[model samples]
Target chain A: MSAQTATIRGWGFLAPAVLWTLAFFIVPFVVMGAMSLATLDGRTLVWGLSLDNYRELAGQAYLARAIAVSLEITLTVTLVSVLLAYPLAWIIAYRVPPRWQRLVLLLAILPFWTSYVVRSYAWLLVLARDGVVNQTLMGLGLIAEPLTLANTRFATVTGFVHFFVMLLTLTIYANLVQLSPNYRKAAMDLGANAFQTFRHVILPLTLPGIMTGAFLTFVLCIGDYITPQILGGNTELTVPQVIMVQLGRRADFPLAAALAIVLMGIVTLAYLAMARWLRLDRL
Target chain B: MPWAYALALFGFIYLPVATLVLFSFQNGSLPVPPFNGPSLRWYGDVLGDDRLVEALLNSLMVALGSSAIAVALGFSAAYALARHVLPASALWRALLIAPLTVSYLIVGLGLLIVVQRLGLGLSLWTAGIGHVVINLPIAFAIIYASMGAQQQNAERAARDLGADEARVVLLVTVPMLAPAILAAFFLSVTLSWDEFIIAFLLTRFDVTLPVEIWSMLRSGLSPRLNAIGSLVFLVSVSAVLLLELTVFRKRRR
Candidate 1:
């Protein structure tokens, strides 16, 4: 084939993907940015370059509170999931025999395949007033009455942490297994205690993995609607829940798009902060 | 101590699924509380609900339809990029893969804005388009990663034998990459099948199973919800096991 023909064929192959991305992804993103600036006058969308929606975000108590709630929930889920997952990944990587590590890791993430919506609902059932957690506590004489576990921030956090812990475990485990044993031995030989070895050597070495996992946890948790929707019980709403309300109830596309843009901004900031260690294709 | 901690974590991980499956057999009206007689009543109810059944079919159609397009586009793109030199290929690849980092909610919202602006009515087709949008990058990545020099060599041999580009791609390239292609399709199906936000935002009366299940959750608590949840769990687990046996097991062997 001629070089010219090969280039044409290459363009042929690239055209579909390029067009699809441009149409559905890039074009829609651009339109959404434009839509965010427009205002709603009595259910009619007014297309204009105005910051009314953003200004509303600043003025409205609930909108600002939603942002705070989203941030607090996201940070809590990210930190807690990482804390829980690191130890689990550590144990799986070092304590479990190599032969069983794959099986162990697979088992750990099996629930990942389940419908995410159903999983959140399942957490609701498990944390309900008469549910297993409270029932077990009361059965063991640990409490005089059933605690308010469901439909609260605690429930929402628990649900988010559960999902993210599984995710963090996978990322952190991949990092842990890739570490050379020589590093640990080298540190110990240099008279570092076990805690010192971990704190000084292993922790620093694995910070990239931790940050990557935490950043992912941040992105996913903050953007998630299902967990908080099912588990949060309208006691308070996250940004996603508020966004949904704007779309579902009031048909407020302008404000919702603004919220979505704010969300994108937060995720962009997170990506920039962790850009060095982000191996997205690897995930 | 490590074993003990591992056991506790495992319990945490499996608790919801176990409870879901258990309550699916609860013979009671509500999904919560003390266990009752084991029964298939709710499962029967899930099968009986016409809307639920229709949603399941909708989910299947969307999953398969979107995945087929995603894989086809992704494969061609992978072949082109892998075989022929293209200018700014790295930039193109980044543009293609940019959606992977963005949240599903944002993607759905963006599509929703565009659709409404265009005055296009929401339907399962729009939902399928959204699924394709998300799954295309994944399909591309998987197929692209697997397109090594070996495939290129085989393609060259085919071309040298006078096999046209179309014939070479259809017969030689696709067959060689069958496993990866099938894996991407199956994975995409699984993702779209269980996907909620995109389908929820993009569709109208016709909804996917996840959207259907969301409605169920919102309306009331029922053993039927448990049944449907367990049913989805069963179907997904079966697909996963099948993939493990066919794909991963073959690779290992």
Candidate 2:
């Protein structure tokens, strides 16, 4: 085929995806950015360059509190999930028999196949006043009365952590299994104890994997609406919940778009911070 | 000690699901403790709910439709980029894969703004579009990664034997990359099926199962929710296990 024909054919194949992304993804993003700057005047959308929505985000206590709550919950989820998942991954990688490792990992992430919405609702029942956690505690004479585990930040964090621990375990396990046994052997030959070998050798090698998983956990946790909404019980709202409220109750597109932009900004910062270790294409 | 900790962590992971499935069979209305007779009453209730049934079908259609579009578009893009030399190919690849990093809420909100501005109404089709947008990158990456020298050699052989470019792609490249394509499609279906925020934001009266389940949740808790949730879990896990035993296992061999 001629160069011209090849070029034409290549572009013919590429045009549909490019155009779809540009029309749906890129164009919508640009429009949302513009919408964020446009103000609402008594239920009228005035489209132009203005920072009224952003200013409102800053001025409103609930809105600012939502941002704080989202960050706090997301960070806690990411940190706790990583701390928990790393050990699980390590155990599965090193302790489990080779034939059974895959099954173990699959079992760990099996619940991930469950509907995302249903999983949160499941958490609600598990943490409800008369639910298993409280019932088990009372059955064991651990408490006099049922505790309010549902409808709180604790519930929201628990839900988020549950999902992320599964995710991080997968990523961290992939990373762990890739390491050569020679690395550990070499470290031990250098007179490193098991703990010292892990600290200096294994941990450093897996930092990229840990960061990648943590970043994913951060983005998903912060942007998530269902878990916090169902499990959080409205005591405190996250940014996504606040964004949904603006869209749902008031039809406040400008403010919601502004909140979405803030969300994008935070995710961007996280990407930049983890850009060195992020293998997005690999995922 | 490691085994003990693993057992504890596994217990933590499965607790909610065990509770959900167990209460799905509860004889009473509430899906709480004080276990009662295991009955299929809630399952009967969930299946009998016309709205939930409709939403389940809608979810299936959207998942299948969106995943098909995503896979087709992704395959062609991957083939073009892999075979032909396009200028600034890296930039195009980056642009295609950019959506993978963004949050679903932002993606849905962005599309919602644009749709409202364009004076367009939201529907399952719009939600399918959103799913395609989010899933295309994944499809692309998976297929692109699997496009290797082995496939390249087969395509060249086909072309050498008087096969047209279309024939080479349709007969040679596709068959060679069937595993990757199938994997991508199933992954996309699973994601779009369970997706909440995008479908919630993009659809109207014709909502998907997740949205319907969300509304059911907001109305109040019941064994019905547990039943539906368990049903979804059972179907999804069975599909996953089937794929694992069939496609992925064969691929490994």
Candidate 3:
């Protein structure tokens, strides 16, 4: 029947993607899980069922601290990104007309178009000892020499905000754009002012956007090894660095696998929870 | 009230890029100030570096190859989801989005182990394979988003007119989805080009631009590196500008 053909066609269309996911995502995860039960005897991983890697993951003080630190950083960064993004999303949605709004949206996305390495390097120059931040601060008598923004947590967080805010703003705007302005106008006609209208109607409607953006930013911030590696000094070790150290340097593949699995669990849980609360597909 | 914060944020964004642009004009080796005079030596230097050029080609090839393949797979997934209420629509949607939620680092780690065991090892093909893995889900999401907005009843109309499934899909569905497909291609290219930890961790000899740039950073700055970074930036800026302008002009018309 015609309906039967559509269904078969649907299955046919889905075959490649399903195969890709199972092969890449499902199978690799199986390998990682299998690997984490291993103990590396030099170059050879003596892989029979074992719990040593998980035990090590649980016991290490530094590993625990690094994971905690990464969680903390992810939370703060997500909050900062969303906080900054809201007003911009508001302005873009309700304030600007269509033509100008498109241009502004383009500008917001502009930074991400370039290589992230180049963008971070640009940040490095701006934050270095003789960098622009200190120069300007000194010019205004805010500080005598450079503020030591480079190779610091501040620098890492700043870089996080720089690249991430645009994505958050856009996600929020996508939701905000479809919203009819009449609700706000009706509220205003009913004696609600700008603050009340925003607080009551606008915020509630855009809650889904905020949640989606926040979820993404949180997941990305925690998993990010690059920004923290480039900017964060030794004093601010994060979870990804620990995994890198284990795998790259010590060749402790089991431990690295175990650590990454834990991170994956956290990310997967957050994603599922977000999807349950607000359909993540809309993102 | 919020104006001050907006201004501060905008300033933070622009100043670093401006400094990078200025330093590219520096005549000497260092990226720091105390410049003598403006020169295009760095730009020349960037163009001259063989390693950088190789990396550039590697990035372009991988991005184009992965984006094309991934977009095809993605368009299929999107079409399936949009056109049918399959046995488990919500579950299928969830599975499609799972990869997007997982970090690129995890995906990289996962794929590296699988492909290495299969004898593919680390090369441009491996990198392209890895890119295809991660980009497929995103391409699906974007195309599906556009699909939801489209008027799909036309396809049904075409189908009722005695057209075959392929004919309906080929004649009606694809033309409607062209813009979304192109946008997905652009997005995939951008994502592939900017992806760092994955390519850096996976590839050995065949590196992407971000990997090349990262390694160069460890040895410290050079006019050559800056020149390369600038070239990468210039290309990125043009691609983004072109994509946005096309969409904007289309919207206007």
Candidate 4:
């Protein structure tokens, strides 16, 4: 078929996806923008094109603190997932053969494929006051009393790592899979040791993968509601949880929208920064 | 890596879930264990738990309804985008794909607000409607991307051979797009099944599994929840394997 005909044909196929996106994705965002403007009155929103909600919520000390906490958690989770993922990803990429590598990668991803709620709920079982971790520690005679692990920042960090490390590992593995195995081999042939070869050859090649993994962790962590709600003690609240709080408990629609918008804004800015800094699209 | 590291990972990831499953069968109440002997009692308990059973049914109703409707609507979108050229096609594709990047909680809130503002009468049905609406783009994008690589000549040939547009679409195009359509349906079901926030915001007394599980977890974790998790695990694994074998027809390696 002619190129013109093919182009026309492609458009015919593409029209549905375009229309779907317009109706659902683009339309909802516009609706969300409108929702952010209206005020809540006893479980109902009194709609008037007013910034009163935004002004009220944005001015609050609570939002600012929640935003910071959200950022801190995102950064911490991003760092932790990356830290755990890179080494394991390295082993799978460089050391393991293709067949075993696939198995290892599958193992990494199997949990993610399982129910997320189940996994998050499972964290509760593990970290409960008289939970498995404590029982094991006490049985081992490591501590006199069962240490407080559940409903702490430590538990949240562990949970995030458990959930997201696979994402980092997979992203990095995809990158490493594309890299030339001979780069490290060449470096080693030139008198560099295994560690030095990896440092010089493998690391530079895999930076894009690392960056992509970190970016996913960062973005996903910021929007996370379940993990923080499950594991984050009353000591702190992430932005998403705060939004849920305003919506669920307080029935504060205006504030929830404002917080949702603010959360989106934070994610947008972080994404833009990462994209610009890493030239992620090019990678 | 050390053997302990792998063992630790297994402990972290599977241990809690396994505990839930084991305790679900335990002759006693709680997963905290000491030689209490196994029992099929928890399944009976879970079966007897009206709220949990109701939640599971509610989840199925939503997932099936949303997946079916979204898959249809998304098929339309994919058909148009992949076979027909709309203006600024790349931008349109990006717009559809953007939600995959955004959080579901935000998406849920955004839709709830929008539906309420439009005075569409927000409820679980409308929430299911919103889910279909949200998932339509995902289905479209996945299908569109899949069809993009195929040659257009097959459809042209079908048309030239005296088939009508409808017949050509059905026999020629759909058969070609079968794998992608299956992928889209499976993805939508999995997504709807797993999605917590949208269901939470949209439902009242009747809630989806994820939302129900969230409430249970928030109060405290129990092994009964693990039985539910294992069921979810079995469903996903079976679905993925079935799709990969039939639709994909590609080896994992």
Which candidate wins on lDDT?
2
Alpha-carbon shift of residue B109 in model 1 (angstroms) = 1.4
Interface RMSDs of the predictions, in order, are 0.9, 0.6, 2.0, 3.0
Over B32-142, each residue of candidate 2 has an lDDT whose tens digit, in order, gives 888896999988988999999999999999999999999999999999999999999999999999898789999999999888888999999999999999999999999
Which portions of model 3 show Cα errors greater than 4 Å? Answer: A1-10, A94-98, A139-141, A269-277, B1-4, B80-86, B147-168, B251-253
Estimate, for each residue in B193-246, the C-alpha lDDT of model 1 and write its tens digit: 999999999999899999999988877677888889888988998999899889
lDDT of 2 by residue, A1-283 (tens): 7999999999999989989999999999999999999998999999999998899989999999999999999999999999999999999999999999999999999998879999999999999999899999999999999999999999999999999999999999999999999999999999999999999999999998898888889898888999999999799999999999999998999999999999989999988989998876556
Q: TM-score of each candidate?
A: 0.97, 0.99, 0.91, 0.90
User: Model 2 segments beyond 4 Å from truth?
Assistant: none
lDDT of 1 by residue, A1-283 (tens): 8999999999999989989999999999999999999999997878999999999999999999999999999988898999999999999999999999998898899898779899998998899988888988998999999999999999999999899889999999999989999999999999999899999999999988898899889998999999999999899999999999999899899999999999999899888988897776566
- What CAPRI-style quality would you assign to candidate 4? medium
Ten-residue region with minimum lDDT total, candidate 1 chain A: A274-283
Cα deviation in Å at residue A219, candidate 2?
Answer: 1.0
Off by over 4 Å in 4: A1-20, A39-58, A277-283, B1-7, B148-150, B249-253
Docking class of 2: high
When just chain B is superposed on the true chain B, each candidate scores a TM-score of: 0.98, 0.99, 0.91, 0.87
Greater DockQ among 1 and 2 belongs to: 2
Q: Tens digits of per-residue lDDT for model 3 on A124-187? A: 8778887667777888898776677888888888888888887888898998898897998899
**Window of ten residues with lowest summed lDDT in model 2 chain A:** A274-283
Q: For model 2, what is the error of residue B3's alpha carbon versus the real structure, in angstroms, after optimal superposition?
A: 1.1
Question: Which candidate ranks first by DockQ, i.e. highest?
Answer: 2
Ranking by DockQ: 2, 1, 3, 4
Docking outcome class, model 3: medium
